[model samples]
Target: MPIPSRAALVEHLVRTRIAGDVATPRDNNLSHYRKLANGDRHYWLGLELGDRWTDEQDVLAVMAERCGVSDDPEHRAGQDTIDPELTVAALDRLAARLRKAAAGKERVLFATGHPGGLLDAHRRTADALRAAGCEIVAIPGGLIADEGMVFQVGGVAVLERGATLWHTHSPVPMAAILDGLARDGSPLPDLVVADHGWAGCAAQRGFDTVGYADSNDPALFIGEAEGTLQVTVPLDDHVFDPRFYEPMTDYLLDAAGLPV
Candidate 1:
Protein backbone atom coordinates (compact mmCIF):
# COMPACT_ATOMS: atom_id res chain seq x y z
CA MET A 1 0.00 0.00 0.00
CA PRO A 2 1.10 3.56 -0.62
CA ILE A 3 2.30 5.51 2.41
CA PRO A 4 -0.33 7.89 3.75
CA SER A 5 0.01 11.58 2.87
CA ARG A 6 0.14 14.25 5.58
CA ALA A 7 -3.55 15.04 5.20
CA ALA A 8 -4.35 11.37 5.06
CA LEU A 9 -2.39 10.82 8.23
CA VAL A 10 -4.41 13.43 10.09
CA GLU A 11 -7.62 11.95 8.82
CA HIS A 12 -6.51 8.56 9.99
CA LEU A 13 -5.71 9.92 13.43
CA VAL A 14 -9.07 11.61 13.74
CA ARG A 15 -10.88 8.52 12.58
CA THR A 16 -8.91 6.34 14.94
CA ARG A 17 -9.65 8.60 17.89
CA ILE A 18 -13.31 8.74 17.04
CA ALA A 19 -13.53 5.02 16.48
CA GLY A 20 -11.62 4.40 19.69
CA ASP A 21 -9.12 2.63 17.51
CA VAL A 22 -6.34 4.49 19.24
CA ALA A 23 -5.52 4.08 22.90
CA THR A 24 -7.39 6.39 25.23
CA PRO A 25 -6.09 9.88 24.63
CA ARG A 26 -4.52 11.43 27.71
CA ASP A 27 -5.74 14.70 29.20
CA ASN A 28 -3.08 16.86 27.60
CA ASN A 29 -2.99 19.16 24.62
CA LEU A 30 -0.85 18.16 21.66
CA SER A 31 -0.59 14.68 23.16
CA HIS A 32 1.67 12.26 21.37
CA TYR A 33 -0.40 9.49 19.83
CA ARG A 34 0.41 5.96 18.79
CA LYS A 35 -1.61 3.40 16.79
CA LEU A 36 -0.50 -0.07 15.91
CA ALA A 37 -1.77 -2.46 13.32
CA ASN A 38 -3.10 -4.73 16.04
CA GLY A 39 -4.86 -1.66 17.47
CA ASP A 40 -2.67 -1.42 20.58
CA ARG A 41 -1.62 2.01 21.84
CA HIS A 42 1.57 3.30 23.48
CA TYR A 43 2.46 6.63 25.04
CA TRP A 44 6.12 6.76 24.02
CA LEU A 45 8.67 5.40 21.58
CA GLY A 46 12.46 4.93 21.19
CA LEU A 47 14.78 6.59 18.66
CA GLU A 48 18.06 5.42 17.19
CA LEU A 49 20.54 8.11 16.17
CA GLY A 50 23.90 6.57 15.44
CA ASP A 51 27.19 8.34 16.08
CA ARG A 52 27.21 11.15 13.52
CA TRP A 53 23.51 11.99 13.76
CA THR A 54 23.81 12.32 17.52
CA ASP A 55 26.76 14.72 17.28
CA GLU A 56 24.91 16.94 14.82
CA GLN A 57 21.76 17.21 16.92
CA ASP A 58 21.99 19.61 19.86
CA VAL A 59 19.27 17.87 21.86
CA LEU A 60 21.13 14.56 21.76
CA ALA A 61 24.65 15.96 22.12
CA VAL A 62 24.80 15.64 25.90
CA MET A 63 23.38 12.12 25.95
CA ALA A 64 25.88 11.14 23.34
CA GLU A 65 28.64 12.66 25.44
CA ARG A 66 27.39 10.84 28.52
CA CYS A 67 27.40 7.59 26.61
CA GLY A 68 31.07 8.34 25.98
CA VAL A 69 30.66 9.10 22.32
CA SER A 70 32.75 12.20 21.63
CA ASP A 71 35.26 13.58 19.19
CA ASP A 72 38.06 12.74 21.55
CA PRO A 73 39.56 9.77 19.76
CA GLU A 74 40.57 8.20 23.05
CA HIS A 75 37.01 8.02 24.41
CA ARG A 76 35.26 7.45 21.12
CA ALA A 77 38.01 5.49 19.47
CA GLY A 78 36.31 2.13 19.92
CA GLN A 79 32.65 2.98 20.55
CA ASP A 80 30.16 5.81 20.17
CA THR A 81 28.66 7.57 23.21
CA ILE A 82 25.27 9.05 24.05
CA ASP A 83 25.26 12.79 24.71
CA PRO A 84 23.67 13.67 28.07
CA GLU A 85 22.95 17.21 26.95
CA LEU A 86 21.03 15.95 23.96
CA THR A 87 18.88 13.65 26.10
CA VAL A 88 18.01 16.40 28.61
CA ALA A 89 17.27 18.92 25.85
CA ALA A 90 15.02 16.44 24.13
CA LEU A 91 13.17 15.87 27.41
CA ASP A 92 12.89 19.62 27.87
CA ARG A 93 11.33 20.01 24.46
CA LEU A 94 8.90 17.18 25.14
CA ALA A 95 8.09 18.58 28.56
CA ALA A 96 7.33 21.95 27.00
CA ARG A 97 4.92 20.37 24.56
CA LEU A 98 3.43 18.28 27.33
CA ARG A 99 3.04 21.41 29.39
CA LYS A 100 0.98 22.92 26.62
CA ALA A 101 -1.15 19.83 26.56
CA ALA A 102 -1.59 19.97 30.31
CA ALA A 103 -2.70 23.60 30.00
CA GLY A 104 -5.56 22.46 27.83
CA LYS A 105 -6.42 19.79 30.43
CA GLU A 106 -5.16 17.04 28.23
CA ARG A 107 -3.17 14.10 29.51
CA VAL A 108 0.45 13.98 28.31
CA LEU A 109 2.59 10.85 28.51
CA PHE A 110 6.17 11.47 27.45
CA ALA A 111 8.77 8.72 27.68
CA THR A 112 12.59 8.57 27.60
CA GLY A 113 15.69 7.53 29.56
CA HIS A 114 18.76 9.06 31.21
CA PRO A 115 22.18 7.92 32.33
CA GLY A 116 22.19 5.67 35.41
CA GLY A 117 24.08 8.27 37.41
CA LEU A 118 21.55 10.95 36.41
CA LEU A 119 18.69 9.92 38.67
CA ASP A 120 18.35 13.54 39.75
CA ALA A 121 17.37 14.58 36.23
CA HIS A 122 14.64 11.98 36.05
CA ARG A 123 13.35 13.02 39.44
CA ARG A 124 13.34 16.66 38.34
CA THR A 125 11.38 15.80 35.21
CA ALA A 126 8.87 13.91 37.30
CA ASP A 127 8.55 16.90 39.61
CA ALA A 128 7.92 19.22 36.70
CA LEU A 129 5.19 16.97 35.37
CA ARG A 130 3.60 16.78 38.80
CA ALA A 131 3.71 20.55 39.06
CA ALA A 132 1.77 20.63 35.80
CA GLY A 133 -0.77 18.19 37.26
CA CYS A 134 0.27 15.46 34.91
CA GLU A 135 0.63 12.05 36.55
CA ILE A 136 4.01 10.37 36.17
CA VAL A 137 4.83 6.67 36.47
CA ALA A 138 8.27 5.18 35.77
CA ILE A 139 8.59 1.63 34.52
CA PRO A 140 10.18 -0.68 37.07
CA GLY A 141 12.43 -3.82 37.11
CA GLY A 142 16.02 -2.57 36.87
CA LEU A 143 18.90 -1.75 39.20
CA ILE A 144 19.78 1.84 40.00
CA ALA A 145 23.47 2.80 40.19
CA ASP A 146 23.70 3.47 43.93
CA GLU A 147 22.23 1.84 47.02
CA GLY A 148 18.67 2.60 48.19
CA MET A 149 17.94 1.28 44.74
CA VAL A 150 18.06 -2.50 44.35
CA PHE A 151 21.70 -3.51 44.73
CA GLN A 152 22.01 -6.92 43.21
CA VAL A 153 24.95 -9.26 42.38
CA GLY A 154 28.56 -8.12 42.68
CA GLY A 155 31.25 -7.02 40.16
CA VAL A 156 33.44 -8.97 37.75
CA ALA A 157 37.15 -9.12 37.10
CA VAL A 158 38.59 -10.75 33.97
CA LEU A 159 42.31 -10.99 33.31
CA GLU A 160 43.62 -12.43 30.06
CA ARG A 161 47.16 -12.33 28.64
CA GLY A 162 47.84 -8.58 28.77
CA ALA A 163 44.17 -7.48 28.99
CA THR A 164 42.40 -7.01 32.33
CA LEU A 165 38.63 -6.59 32.47
CA TRP A 166 37.38 -5.17 35.75
CA HIS A 167 33.78 -4.46 36.79
CA THR A 168 32.03 -4.53 33.41
CA HIS A 169 28.29 -4.35 32.88
CA SER A 170 26.13 -5.43 30.04
CA PRO A 171 24.33 -3.12 27.56
CA VAL A 172 27.29 -0.79 28.10
CA PRO A 173 30.72 -2.35 28.50
CA MET A 174 29.37 -5.62 27.18
CA ALA A 175 28.75 -3.99 23.85
CA ALA A 176 32.11 -2.35 24.17
CA ILE A 177 33.66 -5.70 24.89
CA LEU A 178 31.97 -7.26 21.91
CA ASP A 179 33.19 -4.37 19.78
CA GLY A 180 36.65 -4.67 21.27
CA LEU A 181 36.71 -8.37 20.66
CA ALA A 182 35.63 -7.76 17.12
CA ARG A 183 37.87 -4.81 16.33
CA ASP A 184 40.86 -5.64 18.51
CA GLY A 185 40.40 -9.39 18.36
CA SER A 186 41.05 -9.63 22.08
CA PRO A 187 40.66 -13.03 23.75
CA LEU A 188 38.49 -13.63 26.81
CA PRO A 189 40.29 -14.50 30.05
CA ASP A 190 39.55 -17.19 32.60
CA LEU A 191 38.60 -15.22 35.70
CA VAL A 192 35.77 -14.44 38.10
CA VAL A 193 33.00 -12.14 36.73
CA ALA A 194 30.09 -10.98 38.86
CA ASP A 195 26.98 -9.23 37.59
CA HIS A 196 23.65 -8.28 39.03
CA GLY A 197 20.17 -7.35 37.79
CA TRP A 198 18.94 -8.01 34.30
CA ALA A 199 21.98 -7.01 32.24
CA GLY A 200 24.30 -9.02 34.43
CA CYS A 201 21.80 -11.83 34.57
CA ALA A 202 21.64 -11.94 30.82
CA ALA A 203 25.44 -11.79 30.62
CA GLN A 204 25.84 -14.51 33.23
CA ARG A 205 23.75 -16.84 31.12
CA GLY A 206 26.59 -16.71 28.60
CA PHE A 207 29.69 -16.17 30.73
CA ASP A 208 31.56 -17.85 33.59
CA THR A 209 29.08 -16.44 36.09
CA VAL A 210 30.37 -14.88 39.29
CA GLY A 211 28.10 -13.62 42.10
CA TYR A 212 26.85 -10.06 43.00
CA ALA A 213 28.88 -6.94 43.55
CA ASP A 214 28.78 -3.29 44.67
CA SER A 215 28.48 -0.75 41.88
CA ASN A 216 28.53 -3.07 38.87
CA ASP A 217 28.40 -0.31 36.32
CA PRO A 218 26.84 3.10 35.68
CA ALA A 219 24.17 2.19 33.13
CA LEU A 220 20.75 0.56 32.97
CA PHE A 221 17.99 0.04 30.39
CA ILE A 222 14.28 0.19 31.07
CA GLY A 223 11.93 -1.52 28.66
CA GLU A 224 9.31 0.10 26.39
CA ALA A 225 7.00 0.66 29.30
CA GLU A 226 4.46 3.43 29.83
CA GLY A 227 4.40 5.34 33.05
CA THR A 228 1.08 6.88 34.09
CA LEU A 229 2.05 9.50 31.51
CA GLN A 230 5.39 8.54 29.98
CA VAL A 231 7.48 5.71 28.61
CA THR A 232 10.85 4.77 30.12
CA VAL A 233 13.94 3.33 28.49
CA PRO A 234 13.82 -0.42 27.67
CA LEU A 235 17.37 -1.63 28.06
CA ASP A 236 18.91 -3.02 31.24
CA ASP A 237 20.82 -0.62 33.50
CA HIS A 238 23.02 0.21 30.52
CA VAL A 239 22.76 -2.21 27.66
CA PHE A 240 22.49 0.18 24.73
CA ASP A 241 22.06 3.84 25.60
CA PRO A 242 21.25 5.59 22.37
CA ARG A 243 20.32 9.28 22.70
CA PHE A 244 17.08 9.12 20.76
CA TYR A 245 14.52 11.78 21.80
CA GLU A 246 13.66 13.20 18.39
CA PRO A 247 13.25 9.76 16.95
CA MET A 248 11.22 8.69 19.96
CA THR A 249 8.93 11.72 19.65
CA ASP A 250 8.57 11.16 15.96
CA TYR A 251 7.81 7.51 16.59
CA LEU A 252 5.18 8.12 19.27
CA LEU A 253 3.59 10.76 17.04
CA ASP A 254 3.60 8.40 14.14
CA ALA A 255 2.37 5.53 16.25
CA ALA A 256 -0.43 7.77 17.44
CA GLY A 257 -1.06 8.42 13.78
CA LEU A 258 -0.23 12.08 14.27
CA PRO A 259 1.58 14.31 11.82
CA VAL A 260 5.27 14.81 12.48
Candidate 2:
Protein backbone atom coordinates (compact mmCIF):
# COMPACT_ATOMS: atom_id res chain seq x y z
CA MET A 1 0.00 0.00 0.00
CA PRO A 2 1.21 3.49 -0.87
CA ILE A 3 1.30 5.97 1.98
CA PRO A 4 -1.14 8.80 1.55
CA SER A 5 0.07 12.36 1.27
CA ARG A 6 -0.92 14.61 4.18
CA ALA A 7 -3.40 16.53 2.06
CA ALA A 8 -4.95 13.34 0.77
CA LEU A 9 -5.23 11.87 4.25
CA VAL A 10 -6.89 15.03 5.53
CA GLU A 11 -9.40 14.86 2.69
CA HIS A 12 -10.09 11.21 3.43
CA LEU A 13 -10.61 11.97 7.08
CA VAL A 14 -13.33 14.47 6.28
CA ARG A 15 -14.91 12.33 3.58
CA THR A 16 -15.10 9.30 5.89
CA ARG A 17 -16.42 11.19 8.94
CA ILE A 18 -13.33 10.39 10.94
CA ALA A 19 -12.96 14.09 11.46
CA GLY A 20 -14.45 17.41 10.28
CA ASP A 21 -18.15 16.51 9.98
CA VAL A 22 -18.17 13.64 12.45
CA ALA A 23 -21.07 11.25 12.79
CA THR A 24 -21.10 11.11 16.61
CA PRO A 25 -24.15 12.88 17.94
CA ARG A 26 -23.66 15.95 20.13
CA ASP A 27 -26.05 14.67 22.77
CA ASN A 28 -24.09 11.49 23.13
CA ASN A 29 -20.89 13.46 23.62
CA LEU A 30 -22.57 15.69 26.15
CA SER A 31 -23.94 12.73 28.10
CA HIS A 32 -20.56 11.06 28.29
CA TYR A 33 -18.90 14.31 29.27
CA ARG A 34 -21.41 14.75 32.07
CA LYS A 35 -20.88 11.22 33.28
CA LEU A 36 -17.13 11.68 33.26
CA ALA A 37 -17.39 14.90 35.23
CA ASN A 38 -19.68 13.22 37.73
CA GLY A 39 -17.12 10.49 38.32
CA ASP A 40 -18.73 7.49 36.74
CA ARG A 41 -16.28 4.59 36.80
CA HIS A 42 -17.60 3.13 33.58
CA TYR A 43 -17.07 6.49 31.94
CA TRP A 44 -13.67 6.88 33.59
CA LEU A 45 -12.53 3.56 32.13
CA GLY A 46 -9.67 3.16 34.64
CA LEU A 47 -8.03 6.48 35.41
CA GLU A 48 -8.47 8.17 38.76
CA LEU A 49 -9.53 11.81 38.74
CA GLY A 50 -8.83 14.80 40.92
CA ASP A 51 -11.24 17.59 41.84
CA ARG A 52 -10.18 19.45 38.73
CA TRP A 53 -12.73 17.50 36.68
CA THR A 54 -15.73 17.61 38.99
CA ASP A 55 -17.53 20.26 37.03
CA GLU A 56 -19.17 19.50 33.72
CA GLN A 57 -17.91 22.80 32.27
CA ASP A 58 -14.34 21.85 33.11
CA VAL A 59 -14.78 18.51 31.39
CA LEU A 60 -16.25 20.23 28.37
CA ALA A 61 -13.26 22.56 28.20
CA VAL A 62 -10.85 19.63 28.26
CA MET A 63 -12.89 17.81 25.65
CA ALA A 64 -12.76 20.87 23.41
CA GLU A 65 -9.02 21.08 23.75
CA ARG A 66 -8.29 17.40 23.35
CA CYS A 67 -11.11 15.87 21.29
CA GLY A 68 -12.13 18.89 19.17
CA VAL A 69 -15.71 18.76 20.31
CA SER A 70 -17.71 21.95 20.78
CA ASP A 71 -16.85 24.12 23.75
CA ASP A 72 -20.31 25.55 23.96
CA PRO A 73 -22.51 23.68 26.42
CA GLU A 74 -25.70 25.14 25.00
CA HIS A 75 -25.29 23.62 21.55
CA ARG A 76 -26.33 20.18 22.72
CA ALA A 77 -28.43 18.61 19.98
CA GLY A 78 -26.37 18.70 16.81
CA GLN A 79 -23.36 17.09 15.22
CA ASP A 80 -20.23 16.80 17.35
CA THR A 81 -16.95 17.65 15.64
CA ILE A 82 -13.34 16.53 15.77
CA ASP A 83 -10.61 18.61 14.13
CA PRO A 84 -8.87 16.78 11.28
CA GLU A 85 -5.67 18.67 11.94
CA LEU A 86 -5.57 17.44 15.54
CA THR A 87 -6.19 13.89 14.38
CA VAL A 88 -3.28 14.13 11.92
CA ALA A 89 -1.03 15.75 14.48
CA ALA A 90 -1.72 13.02 17.03
CA LEU A 91 -1.12 10.34 14.39
CA ASP A 92 2.31 11.84 13.85
CA ARG A 93 2.98 11.62 17.56
CA LEU A 94 1.85 7.98 17.54
CA ALA A 95 4.22 7.35 14.64
CA ALA A 96 7.06 8.89 16.62
CA ARG A 97 6.28 6.59 19.54
CA LEU A 98 6.21 3.58 17.21
CA ARG A 99 9.56 4.64 15.79
CA LYS A 100 11.07 4.82 19.25
CA ALA A 101 9.66 1.40 20.16
CA ALA A 102 10.96 -0.12 16.94
CA ALA A 103 14.44 1.31 17.56
CA GLY A 104 14.53 -0.23 21.03
CA LYS A 105 12.77 -3.46 20.06
CA GLU A 106 10.47 -2.79 22.95
CA ARG A 107 7.84 -5.23 24.18
CA VAL A 108 4.47 -3.89 23.10
CA LEU A 109 0.79 -4.84 23.26
CA PHE A 110 -2.07 -3.71 21.03
CA ALA A 111 -5.82 -3.95 21.70
CA THR A 112 -9.08 -2.23 20.96
CA GLY A 113 -12.59 -1.92 22.34
CA HIS A 114 -13.61 -0.99 18.84
CA PRO A 115 -12.95 -4.32 17.16
CA GLY A 116 -15.48 -3.75 14.42
CA GLY A 117 -13.84 -0.51 13.29
CA LEU A 118 -10.22 -0.24 14.38
CA LEU A 119 -8.98 -3.84 14.41
CA ASP A 120 -7.45 -3.64 10.94
CA ALA A 121 -5.28 -0.69 11.91
CA HIS A 122 -4.14 -2.42 15.10
CA ARG A 123 -3.41 -5.64 13.21
CA ARG A 124 -1.34 -3.84 10.59
CA THR A 125 0.56 -1.92 13.23
CA ALA A 126 1.29 -5.11 15.13
CA ASP A 127 2.65 -6.76 11.98
CA ALA A 128 4.94 -3.83 11.27
CA LEU A 129 6.23 -3.70 14.82
CA ARG A 130 6.90 -7.43 14.79
CA ALA A 131 8.78 -7.09 11.51
CA ALA A 132 10.90 -4.38 13.16
CA GLY A 133 11.93 -6.94 15.82
CA CYS A 134 9.81 -5.63 18.63
CA GLU A 135 8.28 -8.23 20.94
CA ILE A 136 4.53 -8.15 20.54
CA VAL A 137 3.33 -9.56 23.84
CA ALA A 138 0.03 -11.38 23.84
CA ILE A 139 -1.53 -11.31 27.28
CA PRO A 140 -3.71 -14.24 28.33
CA GLY A 141 -7.39 -14.15 27.52
CA GLY A 142 -10.48 -14.89 29.70
CA LEU A 143 -14.11 -14.03 30.32
CA ILE A 144 -14.06 -10.74 32.20
CA ALA A 145 -17.03 -9.01 33.73
CA ASP A 146 -18.21 -5.68 32.33
CA GLU A 147 -18.05 -2.65 34.57
CA GLY A 148 -21.41 -1.26 33.46
CA MET A 149 -23.40 -4.44 33.21
CA VAL A 150 -24.52 -6.73 36.00
CA PHE A 151 -24.24 -10.04 34.19
CA GLN A 152 -22.17 -9.77 31.05
CA VAL A 153 -18.70 -11.01 30.19
CA GLY A 154 -16.49 -9.02 27.89
CA GLY A 155 -14.59 -11.81 26.18
CA VAL A 156 -11.09 -11.01 24.93
CA ALA A 157 -9.88 -11.45 21.37
CA VAL A 158 -6.16 -12.21 21.33
CA LEU A 159 -4.51 -11.94 17.91
CA GLU A 160 -1.26 -11.48 15.93
CA ARG A 161 1.26 -13.46 17.96
CA GLY A 162 -0.37 -12.10 21.11
CA ALA A 163 0.40 -8.57 19.99
CA THR A 164 -3.22 -7.50 19.74
CA LEU A 165 -6.49 -8.02 21.66
CA TRP A 166 -9.88 -6.78 20.56
CA HIS A 167 -13.61 -6.45 21.44
CA THR A 168 -13.06 -5.53 25.08
CA HIS A 169 -15.04 -2.69 26.63
CA SER A 170 -14.27 -3.07 30.30
CA PRO A 171 -10.99 -2.51 32.09
CA VAL A 172 -11.35 -5.87 33.82
CA PRO A 173 -10.05 -7.70 30.74
CA MET A 174 -6.84 -5.67 30.86
CA ALA A 175 -6.56 -6.03 34.60
CA ALA A 176 -6.95 -9.78 34.24
CA ILE A 177 -4.34 -9.85 31.50
CA LEU A 178 -1.90 -7.95 33.67
CA ASP A 179 -2.60 -10.24 36.61
CA GLY A 180 -2.00 -13.32 34.49
CA LEU A 181 1.31 -11.94 33.22
CA ALA A 182 2.43 -11.12 36.76
CA ARG A 183 1.40 -14.52 38.03
CA ASP A 184 3.45 -16.13 35.26
CA GLY A 185 6.34 -13.69 35.99
CA SER A 186 6.46 -12.28 32.46
CA PRO A 187 7.91 -8.90 31.69
CA LEU A 188 5.36 -6.13 31.47
CA PRO A 189 4.74 -4.46 28.14
CA ASP A 190 7.00 -1.49 27.50
CA LEU A 191 4.28 0.16 25.50
CA VAL A 192 0.57 -0.42 25.01
CA VAL A 193 -1.25 0.64 21.84
CA ALA A 194 -4.99 0.40 22.28
CA ASP A 195 -8.29 2.27 22.56
CA HIS A 196 -11.11 2.86 25.10
CA GLY A 197 -10.75 1.15 28.47
CA TRP A 198 -7.81 -0.91 27.33
CA ALA A 199 -5.76 2.22 26.68
CA GLY A 200 -6.94 4.02 29.78
CA CYS A 201 -6.20 1.09 32.09
CA ALA A 202 -2.73 0.49 30.66
CA ALA A 203 -1.81 4.16 30.90
CA GLN A 204 -3.12 4.39 34.44
CA ARG A 205 -0.90 1.45 35.37
CA GLY A 206 2.15 3.49 34.21
CA PHE A 207 2.73 1.88 30.81
CA ASP A 208 3.58 4.05 27.82
CA THR A 209 0.17 4.06 26.16
CA VAL A 210 -1.28 5.58 23.01
CA GLY A 211 -4.68 5.12 21.38
CA TYR A 212 -7.56 6.49 19.30
CA ALA A 213 -10.76 8.12 20.64
CA ASP A 214 -13.99 9.52 19.34
CA SER A 215 -15.47 12.81 20.54
CA ASN A 216 -17.95 10.92 22.71
CA ASP A 217 -15.24 9.07 24.61
CA PRO A 218 -13.75 11.52 27.09
CA ALA A 219 -11.90 9.07 29.29
CA LEU A 220 -8.86 8.72 27.01
CA PHE A 221 -8.68 12.49 26.65
CA ILE A 222 -8.77 12.89 30.43
CA GLY A 223 -6.10 10.25 30.75
CA GLU A 224 -3.95 12.16 28.25
CA ALA A 225 -4.51 15.42 30.11
CA GLU A 226 -3.43 13.86 33.41
CA GLY A 227 -0.15 12.79 31.79
CA THR A 228 -0.87 9.05 31.98
CA LEU A 229 -1.63 8.62 28.27
CA GLN A 230 1.07 9.36 25.73
CA VAL A 231 -1.01 10.07 22.64
CA THR A 232 -4.65 10.04 21.49
CA VAL A 233 -5.86 10.40 17.91
CA PRO A 234 -9.31 12.00 18.04
CA LEU A 235 -11.90 11.06 15.40
CA ASP A 236 -15.15 9.17 14.86
CA ASP A 237 -13.89 5.73 15.81
CA HIS A 238 -16.60 3.40 14.42
CA VAL A 239 -18.80 5.27 11.98
CA PHE A 240 -17.12 4.66 8.64
CA ASP A 241 -16.00 1.84 6.39
CA PRO A 242 -13.01 -0.01 7.89
CA ARG A 243 -11.10 0.18 4.58
CA PHE A 244 -11.20 3.96 4.81
CA TYR A 245 -8.44 3.70 7.43
CA GLU A 246 -5.92 1.89 5.19
CA PRO A 247 -4.33 5.13 3.97
CA MET A 248 -3.91 6.25 7.56
CA THR A 249 -2.31 2.91 8.43
CA ASP A 250 0.08 3.26 5.49
CA TYR A 251 0.93 6.83 6.40
CA LEU A 252 1.62 5.98 10.03
CA LEU A 253 3.78 2.96 9.13
CA ASP A 254 5.76 5.05 6.68
CA ALA A 255 6.18 7.80 9.24
CA ALA A 256 7.54 5.24 11.70
CA GLY A 257 10.03 4.09 9.00
CA LEU A 258 8.31 0.70 8.89
CA PRO A 259 7.47 -1.21 5.72
CA VAL A 260 4.13 -0.05 4.32
* Top candidate when judged by TM-score against the true structure: 2
Which residues of candidate 2, in runs, are more than 4 Å off?
Answer: 141-168
lDDT of 2 by residue, 1-260 (tens): 55789998999899888899798889999998888888788888777776668898888998899878889889989788898888998999999999999999999888777777887888889889999999888665443444321111122233221333345556765666776778888898999998888788888898999999888888888888878899989988886589888888898999999977
Q: What overall lDDT goes with each candidate model?
A: 0.27, 0.81
What TM-score would each prediction reach against the true structure? 0.24, 0.90
Worst 10 residues of 1 by lDDT: 220-229
lDDT of 1 by residue, 1-260 (tens): 34444444334323432111222212110111112111212211111212322222332232223222333322322323233333333333343444454454332211112233222223343344446554432222232321122211111112112222222222333333333434555443222112223223323324322121111111211111101112112112222222212233343333333334
Worst 10 residues of 2 by lDDT: 147-156
Q: In lDDT terms, how accurate is model 2?
A: 0.81
lDDT of 1 at 132: 53
Steric collisions counted per model: 48, 1
